[model samples]
Target: NAGVTQTPKFRILKIGQSMTLQCTQDMNHNYMYWYRQDPGMGLKLIYYSVGAGITDKGEVPNGYNVSRSTTEDFPLRLELAAPSQTSVYFCASSYSSGGHEQYFGPGTRLTVT
Candidate 1:
């Protein structure tokens, strides 16, 4: 199975543009997450869902939104993009929330101008 995959490996947006970073895992993991990594900072959780139809904000969900319509898909939406949102975004999943069990996607590099 293809562990985890993300689309549009790279993107550039204007100040107010909007986009959705797509994530899908064929592993059928129940726990999924969206995280952002700045230049030299550790990853910060943006949103997460324990299962389909149950979503919650993470450490940095202010300018982002997420939906889990199925166990394999977790899409992260960036509304009214800002420079502060410029960073590398990652999509991860795990059988449980155990950090060690988590698997990450290739990552999407986004730039806001």
Candidate 2:
């Protein structure tokens, strides 16, 4: 099984263009998260979902949106792409939030110009 997967490993978009980054996990995890990592910094949480139909914004949720409609899929959407949104996005999943180990996807590199 694919522990976690993200589509379109790399993407380039215009300033106004928009796209959806797909994330899926086959581990049946209850906690899912979206994080963005800048060129030379740590990962910043953008959004998280405890389970289906439950979602919350994280530290850096601006310009992005996420919806978790199933136990396996959590997709991040960029409504109006901007240059500042350029970063490497990662999708992670874990069984618990209390210091449990998390599984991460390969990541999606997005470039907005």
Candidate 3:
């Protein structure tokens, strides 16, 4: 399986710049998630999708958006970056196999200056 992949492994943004974090998987999983981890903090859910054409807000969904139109691509949009958003962003997905494991991507280290 190809699993999940993210682009632009590292990025630094200004106070209000915008960017998109791309995530794609090839494992035919039905659930995908986006999370952010601060300097020394645990993972905070940003957004998640049960399947294509369906999406929902997570714990920390502010300043972010997501879409899942197919079974493979799920991208995260950062409308206005902020210092508070300076953290490591990770994309993860899990199969709907009755509480299966969540596989995480490498990560996107974002810095808001």
lDDT of 3 at 91: 96
RMSD in order of candidates: 1.0, 0.6, 1.1
Q: In terms of TM-score, which candidate is strongest?
A: 2
lDDT-best of 1 and 2: 2
Give the alpha-carbon lDDT of every model.
Answer: 0.94, 0.96, 0.92
Candidate 2: regions farther than 4 A off = none
List model 3 lDDT by residue over 1-113, tens digit each. Answer: 77899987999999999999999999988999999998567999999999998899999999999999998989999999889998999999899736799998999999999
lDDT of 1: 0.94
Name the top lDDT candidate.
Answer: 2
> Which is the better candidate, 1 or 3, if ranked by lDDT?
1
Off by over 4 Å in 1: none
**Candidate 2 pairs with clashing backbones:** none
Instruction: For candidate 2, give the lDDT.
Output: 0.96
Q: For candidate 1, lDDT tens digit of each residue in 1-113? A: 89999997999999999999999999989999999999779999999999999999999899999999999999999989999999999999999875648999999999999
Q: Which pairs clash in model 1? A: none
**Over the stretch 1-113, how does candidate 2's per-residue lDDT look in tens digits?**
98999998999999999899999999999999999999778999999999999999999999999998899999999999999999999999999888999999999999999
Model 2 per-residue lDDT at 101: 95
